[model samples]
Each structure stands twice: as C-alpha cells, then as structure tokens.
Target: MQTEYDVIIVGGGLAGLTLAGLLGHQGLECVVIEAGEKIDRVDSVPDDPRALAITHASRNILASFHAWQCLPQDRLACFRGMQVWDENGSGAIAFDSTELGRPTLGYIVEQAVLQTSLEQAVRSLSGISVLHNSRPCDIQWQDDHVSVILDKGENISAHLLVAADGVQSACRAMAGINYRVHDYRQRAVVCVTRTALPHGEIARQRFLTDGPLAFLPMYPDHQCGIVWSTRPAHAEALLKMTEREFNQALQAAFEHTLGEVKESERRSCFPLRRAEAEYYCRERFALIGDAAHSVHPLAGQGANLGLLDAASLAQLILEAGVKGRDIGGRRVLRSYERWRKGENRIVMMTMEGFKYVFENQSSPVPMLRNRALNFANSFIPLKHTIMRYAMGLSGDLPVAAK
Candidate 1:
C-alpha cells in the first residue's frame, strides 16, 4: 500500500493552508481540499466589513512562508497602543508597545488579504496541491493512513489528516468529536466605520453592561473596524437602523472616542457562542483553527490562536518524521494536542473571566475591578507582561513564529 500523501488537510482555510505551506516547505507531500473554487483566489474576495488583529508571532510565521510579503504594504495598519475600559465604572487600563520595548503591538488586517497570501504561498511551494471546488464527503481511517472521499468521487489518502473546517466543522462531526458550545445570548455586530477623527493607530474597546465594543484601525484611511457584541434583541434593533442612525448609535457606543462614526458599511451580525472540541486530535487525525476551539472575539485572538495551532502541529509532525516514527501516530499527535489544547483552553478561560467581569458590573465588583485596573495600569511590569501575551511573544512558540 502506497501512501498518496504525508497529509491531506480538509478545509483550505487559514489553518490548513498555512499548515500545508509549512509542511510543503519541509518537502512533505500534502493536498488541501477546498469547498469552493473562489477560495483559491481569495484576492477576488471583497475587502469589506471585517478585520483581524494579527499578532507578532503570526507575522513571523507568515514571513517565513513568504506570505507576509504578499500583503499590500499600504493596506497594513500597526497599532502601538490599546485602551480598554468599563462604561459603568472607572476600570480603565491602557497598554503601550513602548513599555514592552517594541515598536508596535499588532497589525490590523482584512481576512481576505491573509487568505490570498496564504493560498498564493501554498500554491508556489513544492509538494503541496490544493483541490479547489472540492469537498470531502466522507473520511475512512485505517490502521496506517486515512482516506478522504470527495463528493466528486475522488479519493485522497495520506498518512495524516487534519480538520481546519471551522467552528461547525463537518470533519469534526465525522470524527464524533463532542463540542461544548455555550451560547452567550449575544450577537457580534460588525462594520467598517469612517470615523470623524483619526484612529491614531490605536485599538480601543469599551465594555458596557451588554457587551464589548471594539474600534480597530485600518490601513491608509481614518476608517475603523467596529465589532460590537451585544444582546441578540439589541443587535436586531441595531441592525434594523438606517446607516445614519446606526452610525449615531456607534458614536454613542464609543462615547465619541473617534468623534463621530460618520460613514459605515452595511452592518451585519453573527450569533456569539463559545465552543471547544473534546480533544484536539486522535490517531491519524488532528484539528486546528476554529475546528479545535473558538474564543470570544472580544479579545481578537481567534486567528492568532489558529496560526499557532498550525505552526505547533506542523513542528511536531516534522519532528516525528525526522525520528523515523509515524507522524500520524497517536503519541506524535498527542504531543501536539497537549501543547495547543492547553494554551487554547487557558486563553479561552481568561477571555471568559474577563467577559464575566465586564458583563456583571453590579456594585462591589465594579469598584474592585476599577481598583484592579488602576493597579494594573500603575504597575508597569504587570502591564508589560499582559501586553506581551497579547502580542503572542510570551510562550513556547514554534520555530516558524520565532
């Protein structure tokens, strides 16, 4: 029996494509099965309505793949500072990159930009191929390898299989992985807002009794990516508002931090939920990105966490190959699982803790949180440590990120 590939990654997304690029760079044969043809050319995807906070480690990984260079130089905005506060109390804390001896904290970017870059890099690299307009209908796991059956009757077999199919992953479902989903009873309303004032290269978030509202800077303009998480009923009402009316509400939400939300794209909303798979991997299989876990978007660490998942899994697989061991072996996959799962869990829980603190702004907690924020702000070392973690520079990261 001949193994067709070293890996067959389902869902040609940020995690899968990045993993393919890394493994391909190492001379491993890999195939990425994508659901749509247009996904292969993500540059054509409109740059509208959404953005991500790319961490420093994620940038390094992209740079190693030569994908970072593909992003438009002018379309990148680097934020040097972050300010987070409570709407009901004086619990305010600010972080500056200068304190951490770094020029910037993170880059704000559009997902389309990253998708195009990763797909392009994967295509250029040797030993990796993407099957566009292809979707896997079934997965057959054997003692030695796994075979993916495509809807088009195509068969792809590999020593290892990875699921990067997203939060509601079909692959995860096939694997019988139990997902714990907690509904926040909230919806995240997002849009591109043309602010009256310049963003000044800062990321700002204000936590209200309902939820958190974020203003992330965008490139080459005074535009901000606004992500407002609130109750579903409130989100419905907000979504029903006229553009002018919505911008007015947006201005009120931020309390005129950027003056007025003068112009904005058609706003959209998605239900908020926290989900985690029972395990990150099983024999001959692994999960990455949203397939493995999803954190609250309030922290803006979702994709950053996914990139690290890709890097760490690839690192472990490559190491297993070097030792002449089965890369898809349970032990090899466990090592990757243990590392990524733990980190993702810790981050998710921390976000939950923060969310709870913000959502329950009763009386005593508000005063306590205010004091905690002031204390954290006044204490330079503690603030630097927190900022460092947010920058993705504080842990045992893969070589690609380093």
Candidate 2:
C-alpha cells in the first residue's frame, strides 16, 4: 500500500466513504481509516430498525458517487407523500410529490443497507483504499501535508486530511477544535413495526407534548420504521415494556393512524443532542459529517446533511485540483467551510426551532404554533416553497447534489 496519498480520510462511515469514492473517481489517491471491522452485505431485507430519509438531493449525490447503484432495489422504500400534525391541536400540513411535479418525495432506506452499499462502491474504485480495523493514534499537521500515525505503527501522509468521524470524533478532538453542544434532555426510541393497515406510501409525523413521533414507511406496505422522541423516562419505560404492551402504547401514541400496531421488532434508544464545530477547516485539515455538525433526528436529516457536506467538500477539492491550486491550502479548504457551514447551520437551527415549538405544550404556545402550521398549510405558494426546501431541491447545492 502507498504511504502517501492525495487525501487521507479519517472515519470510514458513510460520509467518509462517499468522499473517497468521489475523489477516487476523479483520479485522486485516497485512503480511508476505519476503527471497525469491514461490514459485509446484509442478506436480509429491512432487518435494521434504524432508517434514514434520503432526500432528492441526497439521492443525486449518492448517484454521483455510484453508491446508489450498489443499493438493493428491494430494500429501498420510496414515500410519495408526508403528513405532519400536532396532537395538541387540529393544525396540520401535508405534502405530496405531485405538488412539485416529482415522482416521489424521498426514500426511506435502512442505515446498514446504505452503509454496506457505500462501502462496496468505495472499494470498487481503483484509486481508493479502505483500511478497516485501523485508527489514527496521532496526527501531525505540517505546512504542506498532514501525517497520520496509526495504531498499527503505519505512517500515512496526505495533502489533505478529512475527518468524517461521528459526533464523538477523535480527529476533532486531536485537532483541538472546540464545539458547542445542546442537549435536548430526551431520547429517541426507534424500531420497526408491522401495522394492521398499509402505510399507503406516506410518511407521518405527530408532534406530541414531549417531542415528535415519526412513522416512516418501509419496503413492505404494512411495515414502518418508528422514531419516537420523548422524555428520557418515557423512552426508558417504552423500552422496558413487553412486545404486546409496547404495541398498545405505540398505537395509543399514534392514535391508531395506521390502525393497530400488530407487532414490532426489538427496540433501541439514543440520547438527543446537536453539536457544531467552532471551525470547519484550518490548513490541511478539514471536518465533514458529524465531526463538523450534528442535529436532532426530528427531520431524519442528519445523514442527508452529512452526505451534502461530503459532496460539497469533494467538489471544492476537485475544483482546486483542476486549477493546480493547493487542495489543502487554507484558501481552498476555507471555501468548502464557508459554503457548508451556513447551509448546515440553517438546517440545525430549523430543527431546533421545531423541537422547541413542539415541546412547549403550554396553552398559548401550542395554540400559536398550531395556527402557524395551519396558516402555512393554507398558503399554497409558501407551502410549496417549504416542501421544495425540505426536498433539497431549492438550495445552493453542490454539483454532485444537483
């Protein structure tokens, strides 16, 4: 293996792999260092309860990296419409693909399935190498290049270092970058359920007193991935309940939107928090994905945002290379930072605002928010604009995302 490359990516997760594949396709030598073992393709369909909402822009970005082609067609669940309502009031908003003259709103894909397909796509690129079960123990940023010292005593050097490690990113810490975090004091309970009635290819979200509850349609007509964000105590209680008891609680929470919750798979829970790096890039080192920023799952947009970050950063790097400019120079790296930071901040703040409004169950706040929802729904042009933004069609997207 080459000890020197054009770029060295820290973290072989979805974002890192996507970046590597894109750069490799552009003929840049890239290496990805992952802490986990290489994951094989999942033979079972829709086995993972954790699902991701792939926006229209995200699909375009994946197709650019050729990862979308690697995904199993049977495992993808495309939702044509969405419905969001408030449980405390009769205010709601609905969106359909036809409103924008599109084929579908977005896709709901299992997390494991997407990652495995991306891995396969990255590995297929001749200029890219994935070093699984290897982690960077030390990093030295020089004037012209960055050196990564791995735990296995291997030394790797690159013109640029990209950190796509998750929220608890070691690279971010090693780079001595500060990040601001806001804890929601809640937990998101996730699982898959088989409802008595079909989902009708529509994603549903109900804003309860605590947080948001989303039922994302999956591959099967009667199965859906449920994300219930609530208080920590409530999430714990839901997890401890038996299958039948949990089903009843879920059904009650959703008000039998899809009839009864007949049965559900195993349950899982994770704390909710949003974090953003103080700086996205400096010198030869740059941050992407959760390492740069992370948001609440209210919109299931964390993954989509990360993918956009990769595409944006990759586009800038490629552009600089074509111009014979130093791809890792501060000028080049800062361009990527400037383009993504504002876009990501807008999304993070939007999710935070939504969470705050939905959680404030007080009398006037709820009434005001409900009215706002209804008013927005009644405004046709505004509703279509919001839908387009949510679908990622009306943004200053990178070429890959476009």
Candidate 3:
C-alpha cells in the first residue's frame, strides 16, 4: 500500500527538515524520507571542524519557526567584525557591526549543531513524519500528485515533492530540470585549529592568487574554523602534511594573525563547483537548498542561502494553501522559481567575479584590487550597503517577510 501525504520531502538534511517543521507548524501534513540510517547528537563544544556563517535573515526565519533558540548558547559565537586583506599587499578592508547598529554581523555555527537542532524541531511537530534508511528509487509525476518509490520497494504519494538533496541532486535529475554546472578547478580545505591568541570575535579572510583563506571565529576564543580554498594539488599536499608542518604552513599563510597555531583537528576537502537549476519547481515538485543552486564559499553564504531557500519556499507553499489554491500547480511553483532564481544568479556571478579578480597574478591587478578594497572601506555608504547585503537583509525576499 502506498502512503499518501500532502508533501513528501526527500533528503532529511537541514533544508528538508527545516521546511518540514515550518509546514507542520502551519498544520500541513508532510513526510520526510531520509537516506541516512540515523541522526545523532552533535558535539556541543565546537569540536566539529566545519561551521557556517549564518546571516541575520536566516536567524529571523529560524526564530519564527522556534528553531534558533534550541541551539546551545555556548555553541554559538557572534562576530561583530570582519577584516579582509590582499595577500600580496598591505591594503585591507574591515567591517564592523556597530557601524550598522547591529549587535552582530553574523554567527558562526557548527554544522552538526545546526542540523541536530533542526532535527529536534522536526521531531516535535506532530504533523510531520520521518522515515529513515530509505532512498527514493523512482519518481512518477501525475496530473494532480506525484509518486516516489523507495529503495525498500515501498511507494509513497504526495501532492508536492520537495528535493533538498545536495549539488549532485538525484531529485533534480529525476525531475528533468535543465541545470548548468561549472567546475572551478579549486578545492576548499576545511579544518579546526587552536590559535595561540584568542580570535576576539573577529572573522578574517585573505585573498590570495590561488584562492581565499577564511578564518571564522568560533566559541571558546582560542579555537577557530579555517576554510582554505586552494588548487587541488596544493590542498592535497597540505592535507597530508605532519601536524607541525601544517601548522607552520598555515601560520605563514595567515601572516601569524592569531599568533602561533599549535594543533589542528581532522582536515577535509571538497571540490568547489557551481550549479544552478533552470527552475526551482515544476507541476508537483520543487527544489530547495543546494539542489537549486550552489555558490562558492568565499563569502560563506552556501548554507545561509540554502536556509533562505527553505524559508522562502515554505512561506510560498503555506500562503498558497491558505488561499485554497492548488499548492502544487506550476503557476504557484513558478513564483518561487522566479523570485529565488534571479537572486541566486546574482550572488553566483558576484562570487565568480571576486574569484577571478583576486586569483589573478598580475602585479597591476593587485594594486587595482587593493584600491577598490580601500575605497570600499573608506566609503561609508557603500560599505553599509555591502554590509546589509551580507547580513541577508537587503536581498529580494519572499512575500512572507513583507
């Protein structure tokens, strides 16, 4: 017998789970099918090597769903300032949250902690159901609904099907949406390191000819999260180096900003790629998070973008349902696509432009880039606009927020 639901969400990651919670809160019946066997407790003390720089808009959305407060206070670290410098020059630009009258520019949150919080929120909603250890083997879209075949040979049907899977999205592929992909020929090496001095709630980034090296301030002061984007060969070498050698290399690259780096946790690497689907939705299917688009992590906007996608998509669905419209209709889903696609494309283009400008080795380019940075730093109005955009407050938003 096939189980039926109003919505069936594939991939129980952050985006899927958060959407499930939001829809359930609105009294919608939804079921989440997760391929993973289980969700476990996230290490509370920032032991995870990866963290996300969550924006204010994302926080607001999560708070509305009553999910943000579930995170442990100790696990969250607020950054009031950010400094960006040219790797070849002494020129730099800095942004302070006080300049914009905001208490924090953003928060650096552990990936596991964020995921666990969303999972807990999902579990508490009575209208949402979770199925683990299952993957969608097939999807069949009908005139009024869609059917999903699980790996266990069980069929499930729903009025709407949501795909929150990552960049290599099986759901998007199954939906037959046109997508464009670009391989950056770069890899991001992420790890945790104990600094000699406290970070003092400041996040830093250095733009080098190879790529960008970002230091995200984490809780407990002396520990920081490192996302070093470099060429694949260089990243591989760095990953295999001994602890002392790795620390030395890291310290040199960062110009000893945090003093001597002593130790590093597990190091991992992921290829940098950009993917944007032609549309975010079809008749009875929708795509959210990485499944829809993925930008470079230079600005640390990947996860935040995914969260925004979730919030906006949820709002659109709920409002349509409230109006007694066909929630899965192409017309309803088109609104989501039209709203989110353009915004995502702009960010992707901006990141690509930044990557190209900073990664060029021409001596003349550095001076020009540094001048631009200094100008941006000295200009109050321009800086404020940039800050607002970075805070996720200035982007094109869904009608729910309005």
Candidate 4:
C-alpha cells in the first residue's frame, strides 16, 4: 500500500517544524508527529531557559519560508557587537558589525519566540499535517517505505523518516545509529536578569577557568539572558542558593559590569555533552538537528547549525523532486550527509578545543589564550574570517540560489 505522505518527522521542535514549513512551501506532502500535547508558544515556554543567537544565514533561510517576518520585531534584539574576554585578566577581543559592513552581526532571540514562529508557520501550511500528543512506539523498515507505530496503536507509513527528535533521539536509536558522546563534565546554568546599565546591543562572553559565562542582550535596556557554564558540583551549589545569593554570585562572576543585578526569571541548569551519530543517513532515514550533532553552547551556534541542516535537507529534497528523482533515495540522502557531516564535525571539534583551552586552570594556558586573543583582535583578516564563520556566511552552505 502507498504511504500517505512523502516524509514523516518525529519531532515538532524548531528543526522539525522549520523543515516541515520549508518542504510544505515546496509543495511536498509531509506529516509531523510530536509527542508533546501542543506546539510550544510563549506561554508554554520550557523551564530550561536558553536563547538563540541567530545569524544572517539562518534569518535568510527562515525568511525564505516566510517564518522570520512572522516573529515580533520587538522581541528580537539585534546585537551589533560581540566581546570575548579572558577571565585571567589578560586581554579581550571585540567584533563590531560596522567593521564587517553589516548592520548587525546577528540577533539574540528567545528560544520560545523562535519555536512559536516556526510552529505557527507549520500550522498554516496546507500540505503539512501535524499530529500532536502522538509518540512513536515502534518503527519497521520495508523495501519501499517505513512504518511508524504510534503509542496509541495507530500505524502510519512514509517514504522517508526524519529524526529531528533532539539529542537523545528515539528515531536514531531505532535506526541503530551509534553515537559517540563526549561528556564535558560541565553544566550550563541559564537565567534572566535586570542590569543597572544597558547592554548597548552588545553580547559578551567571559572565558573563565571553570567555564564560559555569556550575557546575551535582550529587549529593553539593562536586560540580558545569562548562560553560565561551570563544573557540575559548582552548578548544583549555585542552583541551591537563594535568589539574592545567586544574583550576588552572578554579579561578581561578571565583574559587576552591569552594576546591581536582580533575578527576573527562574533559573535552570542542563548538563553539557557533545554527541554525533556514526551515520547521518540509512536506507530510508535521515537525522537532523541535535539528533545528528550537538556541541558546546559556548559558541552559541548549536541551534543555528540545526536550522542550517533543515534548510539544506529541504533544498536537496526539493531539487531532487524537480529533477524527477526519488526524494528518499539513498543517493540523495548520502549527498546531504556528506555535505553536513564534515561541517558539523569541524564545529564540534572547534568547540571542544575552545572548551579545553579556556577552561584550563593552568597559568600558562591563560597566557597563551590571552596572546591568541590579542593577535586575533589586531589582525583584520583573521578577525573578519572568524566573524564571517560565526555569521554562518562562510561554510558548506546548501547549494541553492539566494
């Protein structure tokens, strides 16, 4: 029997929804099976506090699917500058958008807002079907199609199955894809706070011996979202502190740069681990987003990378469809895997290196990092290259007409 759709996505988060919208825009018939009760919105924001540092490339991809404009402008904070410093009190490097001839390097957007926008875009698409509160209990691969059994005993099939189900992806596990995980022995503590001084459209990250502490600018003056990574033991102690104590520690860690700090939202912590699948594609399956690769949050490129993956995969399917080729063919899947795997591996390794170099307590390592930062700041070409990569402009981008 013929399947009802061309593809079945087993997650409704940003990656899944974004891909659904993109494919639907190209007139592809797809269905998204989300385990959650409903699509996440501002009110349904998860307790895990985090924000997205969206680059121009990601914004362009979203805009192509009409998802970018759907977001509230006021909720997005355009950061024109980014500063990285060594906590050893040696040196700091800053990148300004003006120097790169760009209005803004990127925007610091709340994860909830981004998810909400993608969800709405998916909801409005005629060719995309969304099944909420449905979990995949089992999966069977046949020669022509893959069958997914929901927890409710309903069976559905599709030509291809997309695993955007996040880092601990069930689809990836079911497909027997081995994962190599590197535990960083660090935990990321996220929260929101009010500052005495304005952030001035600038985001800052201070690399301490323990981990990296980043302040992402948000809407309204004197407001920013904080992601402070530290050893698991220290993170637990911090999480146990009272609101006043937590704010005091936070202010001190940031050198009181923003003056008095007040906690504006609940705090949350998540363990940091890096994971990459042995293979991004199998016979009739593919992995996207965290399911395929996850890296350190110090660079703030995790979500951006996932969005790029979705965009690239959608482009491959659309182009193949136009050329009268099977979208789920192993040849097409392999092409997508080849293009993204290397790029994702490089990012993971880069983040791992940064984590090691900056988090080392050895006095010599601090001096070395300080010297590297100073050199990077003084060299125009090197600075431009780093900025371009961070903006997602220079990389293995999808082969699609801009």
- The lDDT per prediction is 0.88, 0.91, 0.87, 0.87
Reference-based TM-score of each model: 0.97, 0.98, 0.97, 0.97
Deviation in Å, model 4, residue 221 alpha carbon? 2.1
Relative to the true structure, candidate 2 reaches a TM of: 0.98
Model 3 pairs whose backbones collide:
none
| Model 1: residue 241 alpha-carbon error in angstroms | 1.0
Best by TM-score: 2
Q: Write the per-residue lDDT of candidate 3 for residues 1-402, one digit (tens) a residue.
A: 339988999988878887898888888889998887666565543344688899887888777778888888988898999999998876789999999998999999888788888787787888888888988999998999999999999999988999998788899999898778899999999998999999999999998779999999998999899999999999999999998999999999998999999998889898999889888988899999998888999998888778778878888888889889888888778888887887887788888888888898787888899889999999999999989888888888754332
Clashing residue pairs found in predicted model 1: none
RMSD of each: 1.7, 1.2, 1.7, 1.7
Q: Which ten residues in a row have the lowest lDDT in candidate 1?
A: 39-48
Give the residue spans of candidate 4 off by over 4 A.
1-3, 40-44, 399-402
TM-score of 4: 0.97
Question: What is the C-alpha lDDT profile of model 4 across 322-391, one tens digit per residue?
Answer: 8988888887899999988988888888888888888777778878888999999999999999999888
TM-score for candidate 1, residues paired by index: 0.97
Model 4 residue 249 lDDT? 92
